[model samples]
Target: MSNLTARLRASLVAALPPEQLLPDSQPEYVRSYVYVFGATTLASFGFLIISGIVLALFGPGWWHVSRIGHFFNSIHFWSVQAFFFFMVLHLWAQFFMAAWRGGRGITWLTGAVTFVVSLGAAFTGYLSQQNFDSQWIAVQGKDAMNAIGIGAYFNLLNFGQMYTYHVFLLPVAVAALTTVHLLQVRRRGVVPPIPPRGLGG
Candidate 1:
């Protein structure tokens, strides 16, 4: 039986006693290199959140000027890079595998939505840096935002607004969506591999 199916049938197998459920905690490590893209993206996101909390506690001045703050800033920045890197891999892998097969359409949908929200979070993050770079971004973006008819509301030039979005609103949205995505995965389990051509047919 597949590992996931066996695990899901735990209650039925519980009657088998300890001798049968060997290595219950240990996962199939051999699958990690190919199958762990989603997990790796999550790990990167964890680092992003922790490092972001540190940077937030210190405020803009400290992060832009202080040495220790610079260290954490680097961590947060690199974590974003890693998050996107593994997220793309996970997304594409799921796409090609048709992970929406079976009743997993919502699972795939949640993941796709999370990616779009993460983009907004990352964009606001660039604006929250509170430096010349941020000023340049605001100047360049404000006109576009106005042209698009949201500048009055969003006000990309407003540091406090962008900072609040980067620090609070968008992050919460991403986290909430990610949580729902995870719950869906747990509910339906991962999609199984496709059968070979003409094999299952």
Candidate 2:
């Protein structure tokens, strides 16, 4: 364990350098509205995770019955909504910037996959709510899932299973995927935009 930790630490130090990792200096060209959107989107995801944890710990049904639980539930719901909102904006920005152009194609693709998985996670979460909306979505979504044969493995009508998935399984998968995606981003570095053709003087 100690050796692994030392090796990991060494690798990070080699890749990032002390100054860049804890940044006393930044590139002048890094200034742009585009940069802010990435940070904002990340912050929204952080909010969602924190709020979701609170809801999970309190128990989803507890919120409907208890005052504090209800408040946390509200926060969780708002956080989810905020997360989706920022994610959409972030994706649009990346698309407009043509961010997939360089070796950063992996980063772009990984992010796209993560976004798709996040949408699934979000949908399953809503279905697990066990409310009127939950019932409606379950009955509606089951047809699509059944048609695709995923319903065999994932039963939307089983509240117990759906709840477990939303609280534990789905989040774990998202966390794993996000970890890999972030590692790819850090390794590849951010992609620079393509220069115009025939611009040389």
Candidate 3:
């Protein structure tokens, strides 16, 4: 047991050195408005999760009937909007900076996957709403799912299922993927800015 534990510790230390995992400082090039967007995106996502939890706890009906519930609902709604807005800005900035240049392809790929999955989460949230908008979205989503031959398994009209997906499964998946993406980013430090044309070899 002791030998096995030693091996595990060695492997972990080699894979993620303390300096890299918990850096005290970053490269000078890291100070830029573009880099700030990633932090903003994370902040928005944090609020989105908190607001979503409040909505889920009281059930969907409360949001439509009570003032407090409505307040939380509005927070959740606006947080979703802000999350995507910041995410898009972060994505564009990273793309322009070629963030995958320093062996960070997996980090970039995971972020992209998270965005795509978030769209599904948002779609399910719309369907789970007990309102006219939900009805319209369910009908439209059903047609789209049927066209893709996935309607049988993924019924947009099923409020319970959509709610389960939106409030539970999708959030878990997004959180897990986001964690991996962040770990990768830390493992392989941020990519540096491109050098000026005249300065290049």
Show the lowest summed lDDT stretch of 10 residues, model 1: 21-30
Model 3 ranges off by over 4 Å: 198-201
What lDDT does candidate 3 reach at residue 85?
94
Please state the error at residue 166 of candidate 2 in Å.
1.0
lDDT of 1 by residue, 1-201 (tens): 569877767855554344333323433333545468999999999999999999989887797678899999999999999999999999988898888999999999999999999998998999998778888999999999999799989999888999999999999999999988877776666677777798974
Clashing pairs in 1: none
Error of 3 at 23 (Å): 1.5
Number of the top-ranking candidate, with lDDT as the measure: 3
Q: What's the lDDT for all of these models?
A: 0.86, 0.78, 0.90
TM-score per prediction, in order, is 0.82, 0.86, 0.94
**Per-residue lDDT of candidate 2, residues 1-201 (tens digit):** 369988999998887675554555445655678756666767777877887888888777887788988787788788788877877887898898787776778878888888888888888889877689999999999999999999999898998888888878877777788777766656656556568788656
Q: Can you list the residue pairs that collide in candidate 3?
A: none
The C-alpha RMSD of each candidate to the native structure, in angstroms, is: 7.3, 2.9, 1.6
- Number of clashes in every candidate structure? 0, 0, 0
Question: How close to the true structure is residue 87 of candidate 1, measured as C-alpha lDDT?
Answer: 97
Question: What is the clash count of model 2?
Answer: 0
